[model samples]
Target: MAINEKSPSPAPAIVESEPATRCGSNTPGLAATSSNNGEKPIAHASLEERAGALAVPPPSGTTSSRYRWLVHVQFFACCWAMVVAGWNDGSTGPLLPRIQEVYGVNYTIVSLVWVFACVGFLTGAIANMFLEPRFGFGKTIFIGACFQFVGYAIESAALPFPAFVLGYAINGVGMALQDAQANGYVSNLPNSSTKMSFLHAAYGLGALASPLAATQFAQLPHWSFHFLISFGVALLDAIILAAVFRFKTHDECLAAIGQVRHLDEPSEKNDDSGSETEKSHFRKVMTLKETHLMAVFILVYVGVEVTVGGWTVTYVINERNGGPSSGYISTGFFGGLTLGRMGLIWANNKIGERKALVIYAALAIGLELVVWLVHSLVGDAIAVSFVGFFLGPMYPIAMNVCGRIIPPSLLTGSIGWIAGLGQAGSALFPFITGAISNKAGIESLQPIVVAMMAFTIGLWICVPRDKVRTASPSSSSPEGAGAIPPPPRPVVNV
Candidate 1:
C-alpha cells in the first residue's frame, strides 16, 4: 500500500537509497535515478536500492498546438478500423440466408462460419500479445488489416463453403487484433470513456450502413459482392491505421499518442529483453481475477449484441412473417445503437458509467421483453431498435472499466483476450441461436437473447467495481513495463 516517490530532477550518483518492495515493478512509485547514464534500471528485482540510472531527460520543449491537432486526427483514423469491424459485423445477419442457399447447406452448417471466425479471433488475440511487444502498436494493427484483406479476398472468390468459412475466419482474426490494439491505445488517454464512446459510435454508423448496403449488394447476381465492399474498406482502413499509429516501436507509438514524450530519446530505439519481458508480463497478468472476469463479461455482452443483430433479419422474415421488407429492421436496430452511443456518451459521464449501464440494461431488457411478446411487426421492430440503443454504450463502458483495472504491463494481452475471445461471443452465441432455431425455430432467438442478457447482467455485476487509477508519466506509455499498478484489491472471482 506504500508508494515510492522520486524527484523529477536528476540526482547525484548514490551507492544506496531506501529499498522498494519486490514484484511491484509496474506499481507507480518514484524511481530513483543514479547519475550513471549508460546503464538502464534493473527490472523485476526485489528491494530496489539505487537501481541503475534512468536515461537523462532530453531538452524539454512544448509540442505545438498544431502538432496536437494532427495527433487528434490519428484518433479518428483508428476509428475507421472499428468502422470496418462494424461493417463486417453488421453484414453477417443479413447475408446468412443467401449464404445458406448458395452453399446448399442448412443453417447449422452455414453458421459454422461464426465458429471459424471466433477461432480466428481467439488466435489473433493471443498472437497480439507477442506482436505488439515486437512490432509496436502500428504494425500489429497492420498485420490485422492484412488478415482482413486475405479473408475478404478468399471469400470474394466465391469458393466452396469451407473456403468461404476460412475467409470470414481470417477476417475475424483481423478484427480482434486491431480491436485490442485500438481499445488499449485509447483507454489510457484523457477522457477515454467519452472518446471510446465516439469511437464505438463510428462502429454503429458502419453497422447502420451495412445492412442497407449489403442487402442491395445481395440482390446482385453475385451475392458475394458484399465481401468486395468489405475488402475495399479494409484496404482503406489499413492505409489510415498505418499512417496514424506509425511508430518504429511501442515507445514511439506512445509518444505519438501523447502518453510519454522523450526530449532526447532518438528516432530509433530498442526495448530491453522485450521478447522475454513480454512473456513474463503475459504470465504475470494472467493471474488476475479481474482479467478473467472482464473476458467473460465481454463474451456475454458481445454475444447478446451480435445475436440480436445477426439473427434479426432471419427472425423477422421467417418468424414474424414480415417478408423481405422487414429485413431493413436491422438498420433500425443499428440506427438506435448509433444514436444511443452518440447521445448517451456525455450522459454517461453525468450519470456515471456503472449507473448508466444498469439503467440502460434494465430498459433494454424491458424492450427485449416487448419484442419477444408482442407479435406485431411494427411493435417488435420498435422494441428491437430500442434494445439496440440501450445496448450501445455497454461495450465502450465495459472496456473503459477494463482499462482502469488492468496493469499497464499486461494491457495488450489482457485487452486482447477480453476484446478478442470476448468477440467469440459474436460467433458462439449466434451459432447457438442458429442451432436452436433449426430445432425450436427462429422464434427461439428472442428467448435466447433474453437469456443471454440475463447471463450478461450476472457476469457484469461480477466485474470489480472499477475505480479509475491515476496513471503516472512512466505508466502511461505502453512501453512502461515497470510502471506502477492501480490500487490493489483482495482476489475475488465471480
Candidate 2:
C-alpha cells in the first residue's frame, strides 16, 4: 500500500473527464464525458495512475501466495458448499425411485422438489442484494453456511414433502448467497478467474464424489443418511469460515488498491467551480445508458453460463447414448470442467483475461458442436469434458467485466443483481431442458446448448472495451482513442 506522487502539473482543460460518483457514493450519479469534446487533455499518464487507484486493485497477499493457508481454507469451504448443493441436485435423479418408494410420492409431486431449489435460488439471489453490501462477502458466506446446514438438517431428518420442500428452499437461499458472494470474491482477486475455475471445479469434484457416496449409501435402509452427509459438509464449511474471518480475499485487496490509487491523484480543487455542472451531466448519463445496459448484460451472462453447466451433463447421458452409467457421465462433464478450470489458472496468468475468454469461447462452441454431431457415447463424453475446459472461464470473466463496468458505489448491489439474474437464467434454461427432454427426447438438448453458445458470443461482442481497461483520460485521450489496445500481459509476483 504505497503511493508515490510525482510533481503535479496545471490541470489541463477538460478533454473527456467523465465524472463518476464513487461506489456507495452519497453524491449524485456520474456524468458522461464524450470523447468528441475538444477540451485540452490532462496529463494522460498521471490521470491513468489515478484512475487505476480508483479501481480496487487485486489484493497483494490477503488471498494469494504467502497467504496460501488462508486460500486453502476458503477454497475448502467453497468446495464444501458446491459439493453438497450440487450433490443435492445431482443425486436426486438416481435417488428418485428410492425416494418415491419410500415416500409413496407420485412423479409429478417429486418433480416439484427439483424445481423448488430454483425458487430457493431466486429468493436467495434477491436476499444477497441486501446482505452482501451490508455484511461483505465473507460474512455473507458464513451466514449462507448456517442456513444451508440447518436446512439440510431438516431435510435429512425425513420430514413431510412440504417440510422437505421448505428445507430445499432454505438451502437454495444458502446456495445463491454462497454462489454470488464466493464467485464475486474470487473474481476480484488478482488472477482470480483461474482460481475461480478451480474453486468451481471443486464443486464438480464434490459432485463427482457424490455419486459414489450416494451409491454406497443406497445400500443403507434410509436416504436420510445421505442428506446427513450434506449437512455435515455444510457444518464443516461454517467452522472453516469462522476460522478464516481474519483473512482477506481478492475483494479486500482490490478495495485497498483502489483507495491508494485514488489518494495519489490530484484533487478536484481546480474544477470546483464547474463541479456542479459536471455532476449534473454525470447523473443524466448514468441513468440513461451505463447503469441499465450493464444490468442487462449481467443478467444475460449469468443465465447463459449456468444453463450450460447445469444441463450439459444431462444432455450427454440422456441423448447421446451415455447409458445407465450415463448419470455418472455428468461426472465426466464436471471432470472436464475441473480440468478446464485448472488450465484457466495458467491461461489467465499467461494471457490476459479478455483474450483468454475469447479463446475459451471459441473452444467451447467447437467442442459443443463436436458433441452435438457425434452420436457415439465415447465421442460425446470426450467433447463434453472439453466443453468444460472452454466453459471454465466464462462465468468469472463475465463477473470481472461487471466489476469493471459498474462503479464501486453500486458494486455489491449491481453484482448481486447481475448474479441473481444470471442464476435465474441458470434455473430457467435447465428447467426448460428437463421439460423439453420429457417430450422431445433428450437428444434435442444439443440444439439448445449450441444456440445458447451462439447467443453468448453475440452478447460478448457488445461488451465495451473501456469496461475492461482503465478509464483514465490518458487511456482515452484523443490521440490514443481509436487505437486498438494491445493484449494484456499477466502480472507476475516476484
Candidate 3:
C-alpha cells in the first residue's frame, strides 16, 4: 500500500501559570485552563514568585532595580581615577626639564621614566588577566589604586633616580588595571558612546590642568612636590573605590545589580570547567585578527598623542625659542583635546566613527604640518591646540568600536591587553623621540608626529567593522525560534 506523504501535525500550545520544573523539582499540570471550556485562565506569576519557586540564583547580567545607585557611584569613581591618571601623564611633560636638572640627566636618561612606565603597563595587563578572575573587579581596582598611591608617594619625596623611575612603573600598573576595568564597564552601558566621550573628557581636564600646576612647580626648588598632589588624589581614588565596590567579586556585583545571566536556569558547572572556559575564551580573543589590529592602531595613536603632549613644551622652548611661558602650549593642547571630546559628540554621530576618525587624522596631520612649517610661536601654539582637539576623540571612539567588535564574554581581558599594550606606545615612541632628539634635536618631533598620524590612518582602515544583526519580526517574540535577545539598556542618569 502506498502511504500519503504529509508533515506531522504541530503540537498543541500550552500556557503555564508557573514553570513545570522549579529548583530541580518537577511540578506538572500547572497549565492555565481554557476559557472556551468555561474555566478561568490563570494569571502569570510575578517575578518575586518566580524567583521564590526557582531556588537557583540568576547570572551576573540580570538587572536588580535596588542596587542601581551603586552603578552611578562606581562610574563617578572611575572618572575620578581617570583624572588622576591624566594628572600623572600630563605632569611629565612640564616637569621633564626640572627632572633633568635635578638628576643631571640628558633627554635619554629622562626618557627612562617612560620606558619603566611601559614595563609596568605590560606587566599590569598580563596580571589583570590572571588577577581579575581570581580577586574580581573591586579588589583589582582597589589594588591598582594602592599601587598608584605608592608610586606617587615615592615620587613626591623625589627619591634617587632609580627609585623615582620605579614610581612610574608602579603608577603604570595602577593605571592599566583601572583603565581596563573602567573602559570595559562603561562600554557595556546605555549610550556608551556619549559616556565614553565624557569619561575621556575627564582625562583631558586633568591633562589640561596638570600643565598649569607643573609649570609653576618647575620653577620652584621643590619641583617634585607636584607629585604630592598626585599622591593625595590617588589616595582618594583608593578610598572611593574600596567603599563603592565593597570588595565585591565581579559575579557578586552583577548579582547585586540584578543582571544575572541564565536567570531561569542556573549552571551546574564547577570551578574547573569555568577555568577551562576562560582559557578557551582567552585563546579565542588572542587569535582574532581584529585584536591585534586594534592594539597596533591604539599604540600608534597613543604614541602620537603623548609624544605631542609630552614634548610640545620642550619643542616650543628650544625649537620655537619661547621662554617660561612655553609650558602653556601643553595646556592649550590638552584644552583643545578636552573641548573636542565634549563638543564633537554630534559630529562623531553625524559622520560615523570610521570616516570621522579619518577626517580627524587628516586635520591633525595638517595641524602638525602647520606647527612644523610656520615659524610664528603664536601660530604653532594655536595649531598644536587644534591638533589636540582633533586627536582627543580618537581614543574613546576606538574604544567604543573595540567594545562592539569583540565578544562580550572576552571583553575585559581583550580590553586589558589592548589598552595595556597600547599604552606602551606612550612610553616607547616618546623614548624613541627623546633618544633620537639627543642627537637630531627636538625639531625632529614634528616629523615623528606626522609620520605616526599617517600610520594611524592606515591601521584604522584595517580594523574590522562591527557586525549588526537585525532581528526578524518572529525573532522579536520571546518564544521565537533561533532568537537571540539583546542586552538591556539601563540608563544611569548620572
* Predicted structure with the largest TM-score when compared to the true one: 1
Tens digits of per-residue lDDT for model 3, 1-494: 12122222332211111111211100111111112455322223344343333332222222333345555666687788888878887888999988988999999999999999999988888787767765667888899999999999989999999999999999999888988877766664435679899999988988999999999999998998999988888999999988877887554444343333222111212254467644654575577666778889988898898999999899998987899778889999999999999899899999999999999999999999999999999999999999999999999999989876654445667787888887788889999999999999999999989999999999998898885211111233432322222222222222
Which pairs clash inside model 1?
Answer: 4-30, 6-30, 26-483, 26-484, 26-485, 27-484, 27-485, 28-484
For candidate 1, lDDT tens digit of each residue in 321-347?
Answer: 876556578888988898899898877
Evaluated at residue 126, the lDDT of candidate 2 is 69
User: Given candidate 2, what's the lDDT at residue 351?
Assistant: 88
Q: Distance (Å) between predicted and true CA of 89, model 2?
A: 5.0
Reference-based TM-score of each model: 0.83, 0.67, 0.81
Of candidate 3, the 10-residue stretch with the lowest lDDT total is 23-32
Q: Which candidate's lDDT is highest?
A: 3
Give me the displacement of residue 245 in model 1, in angstroms: 2.2
Candidate 2 backbone clash number? 11
Per-residue accuracy of model 2 over 1-494 as CA lDDT, tens digit each: 32222233332111111122222221111111112355322222344433332222233544344444544555666666666655655555445545656778654455455467668777887677555434545677788888888888988888888888788778878877877666655544434545666666676666566656664554478877888888888888778766665333223423322311122111222243254533433343235334455545555544444445445544554566444455455566556666666666767668877777777877888887887887778877777767866775666666666666654334444455565555555555666666776678667777877777777677777676644222222345432232222222122242
lDDT of 2 at 317: 48
Identify the runs in model 2 with alpha carbons over 4 angstroms from their true place: 1-111, 133-138, 187-194, 215-221, 246-323, 346-352, 355-359, 468-494
Stretches of candidate 3 off by over 4 Å are 1-69, 254-278, 468-494
Scored by Cα lDDT, where does model 2 land?
0.56
lDDT of 2 at 162: 86
